[model samples]
Target: MVRAQVLHGRVLDAETQQPIPNAQVGVADNRLGTSTNDDGRFVLSIPPAYQAARLTVALLGYRSHTQALPPLPGPELRIELKISPAALGEVQVTGLVEGIVREAVARIPRNNPARATQLTGFYRESDNDTIGRPRYLVEGLLTVFKPDYRQPGDDGDVQIRQVRKVDLRPAGQAVRIDWAGGPFIAQFGDFVHRRAQFINPRHFRDYAYRLGPGSSYAGRAVYVVAFGPRKGNSRADCEGQLYIDQASYAFLGAEWHYTAGGLRRARHSGASSRQLRVAYQPYAGRWHLKTVWWQTQARLPIGPPLNYFGEFLTTAIDTAQVARPGYVERAQTHDVFLRTTVAYDSAFWAGQTTLLPPAALRQALLDQPRQQRADSLFRRRRTGADSSTVGPAARPTPRESGRLGFLGRLSFGAAVGLFPLAGAGGELAVRYTPAGSGFALRGTAAVATPGPALATSFDYQFVLTKTLALRLVTTWLHGQFEGEGWQLGANYQRNLRPGHRPLYGRAGLAYIRQTVAYPVGTFDNPDDALRVAGTKLGADRLSARLQTLTEAVLPTLGLGLELTHQFELVADAGYLLHLRTRAQLQLDEESGFFLTRSSATINLPNADVDLRVNNQPTATLPWQPQHWLLSVGLHYRLRP
Candidate 1:
């Protein structure tokens, strides 16, 4: 009788000692394997077919670990993974990078899969909009029949096993995503299996490279190569880092992004931007494409940022490449944007596979249970002997559950700003955002005791992409200090972030119109004291002006400790525009009622600059009084 044993383990980072979730663990030639869960724990059933086989554990950005079959006196295994040394340091090695590339090119076939294999995979995708919300998400299970590894383009076929999805399309979105054909897109991302679909093997000489230190992958060392277009070659190009297996000179994985040259060359290609990555591992004997991730963003000429993100995670379930005649015929192969299966079978997924099922997916299939049946299966296996699986009623995840309706998309917020000389004021605001939609509307009512005033504002925002937006605001106010004022403004801001830091650059144009209250005859006398000037007056006067301005400023980027997901620490610092302040003198003709009179536009002192500051009588800001605005405040926006 063959001996079978069950094993449990947790994977962790060697240095941080923190659990590393999503690590893959299995034995060579073994029929069963599993991935660590959120807590970095996994349970594996050692199949009798490979009781003596060694186990392999791997994760992205870390060195892989290998060990003999488990049950080495202990009931559980704890694996600590160290960071890959290849990525630890960076040094210029351009010649070395080019040499490695040459070697990898010649040995591509030997380093990659030689035969075909059947793969079971889970694909999930999510998108973050301008507002930084996970508004769109999708997942699919697939069965892929790959052709010979060397000839990836010849004919790899895919069939969807099951699918699930959720989308919160921000309201009034004219652009609704049609994910019906995304499965094929996922297939194209398999640079190892479908190698020819994206980058060409023969074009390696056209790019430039810079080599970094070697790193560990799948228990082997790999050269870290960074490459992009060379010199004045402004043509479209792929630029990113690559991991090349040092022994066989095969590319184990790569993370690539498009460069400006690439964008220029592909201007007519209908491709805007892409961030892609793919990795492979030795699965069921030979190398199998383990993971493929790609996110594409649509270029907006005048619209919101629209993006598609796809991930493909594969496990070798079976293989039949040698027995098959040629490749699956195009006519026989299924082609599609993956559609969610209207009905899901709970038992089908419960069948053992190498990879752990995603928790959200299991939750969807298990009749909306709070916890999955798999978690119970593990518990029973741990505590009770001779465990049997339990199946739930079959049904599709509710369609209505994915929708974020009117109230769900509404966000309310409040803010208070110190007006320096004018005193403190607060605003109550209501904002509405449609899921995945790039548009938002805000209505605000404000009150200030020092200004002893009441005001209201209506604002609108439309995002063009991650770093850009168009803002429109109109405000009406009445008070003793501010007088009856109405302001209309619009700005287009481009926010550029510098890595994960709080520093960012902002450049935008703005238009402003407002009414300013000041005592008459208060202008600093400049007409040579000898000349007679206007007499002093006790009555107040109102001056309404319109200004068109452009400014460049730096603002902070990133979030504060989230008391609530929507609560944020917001801050801004920058210079306002320097422009002519134009207005008609509406001096109080009688009892504080202003009458229109001829007034000329004013410039800053010496005409060099009017440094927009609170004390500058000629300057009026859209929000606050200070010439140079610096703001740090607690901000909350409804996220539900």
Candidate 2:
């Protein structure tokens, strides 16, 4: 039979001299435990077998106290545990300082099983060097009021909100998502690696011996320790030191630095880099991340130029997609900052497991968005600043602004020689504007190269005003037989309407130069055929087009039907004018070519001749005075 003794205890706040109800009391080794009632009194029953064992007392947001009990007869004993605010409040720092923190943290066992928890507390964070003023020095309290609960059949829902100075809003916003997920356990485990990383005890076995000695800060005794990668191990992204309370072994603060060496290449063109920082007095005993302030800088090597593959003309048979063959390498730098805080309510921690009433949870979730909007409105009302407005009173915009935009098409209708007859190409554009309307210049280069052929183009567009636009476009092409060309045109657009859907009309004139090589014999070898064509082929083309455009229909499905008429005066000297008009069609909803270009041949040089260029008198091919080009395709406006 087991002999036992019962002990009684009362927990009280040291500063307030008030009893703390619902305080937890338990044996150090056994699971036997009970909590104080409304009167802050607890009765603990211990077996005689544990006469020499210690008993631990704890309360939410309070320091845990342990004491050994002497052998006793069947009698009720009384004990008192005092709450120390400083000892009960501190954040957990992993990595280099984890050992020091674990000494104090191990004394407290997690009693609350609820995955979701709301913490409300004040915070003060700073750097370890103390060179300049702390980055986040403000003191404020926050409440989760609503914690996200992931129960069976529950919808994925997350709600987070907080209030702080405009300057501090960024840090607050960064953590709101984590807080809504519940307590820091999930976020902590996710951020800190428990395997061979920071939080793993196996990896940090030598930490205690390496810590060396203790130190003092601001008259408060603190233990200082440094950490680095173990011998035979490569350098890691993180390194840091911890400051612990020497007396209670509690973690007072910590400073850590991280560098993603290889990851830097993934960010941008430049040399890879890393960062360092410190966090102080950010949370209470819950090991909650209060506030973290870090500064990081990186250097990345410039990367190779982007390769875009796709088609240019949506309609055309035997069209090739073009690719931009250029290289770009650049270097960049960046600075970042972060902070967070948590609050706790003892009452919420000492309760039975029960689903939060639906009505309460609903109200809590809804209140979050409303609070954020209210905060925004309040700030605008208080500051009287409307950033959307323009004019002399508006905020000045930053200099050096540019945008990169691209469009491409790739499609195939059928297989040829076990390979799809596909085409792909894309365009790249860069623009610069010193002022909104003054000296705006834009440059564009595009290429589409498919099997057996390639087409490339370059264009420059200059907008002098909201109503005037000037453009110059030129193209060069190469195919199985060889071809090249250039076109120059200018258009002026005048807006007829100003609101939501604006209407505009444009007119332009174009001059084109083209050349094509034709085979003279049945050349079975491609290289031999090319050599023969180059030696005996006739190639020449000079064309001028006067065009008029009119919009007849426009609809929401992004389908626009426009009528265009162009007068083409062709000067094809001697060679046949192989006028092949084609269209390549693709559906916005699916992959693959939906339609091929409608083609009509208007043969030139009515009289056939044996092509010995020197023997044929220079002759101009049949000229067509007017040509009508109808374009029927879907053009969807991208969603904002």
Error of 2 at 324 (Å): 46
Provide the lowest-lDDT 10-residue window in model 2: 310-319
Write the residue-wise lDDT of candidate 2 on 415-513 in tens digits. Answer: 011101123323323222222222222333332432332444444444545444344444343443233344444435453443323334444444444
Tell me each candidate's TM-score: 0.48, 0.28
**Sequence-dependent TM-score of model 2:** 0.28
Best by lDDT: 1
Question: Which digits, one per residue and each the tens of the lDDT, describe model 1 over residues 497-526?
Answer: 332222334444445444433222222212
CA lDDT of 167 in candidate 1? 43
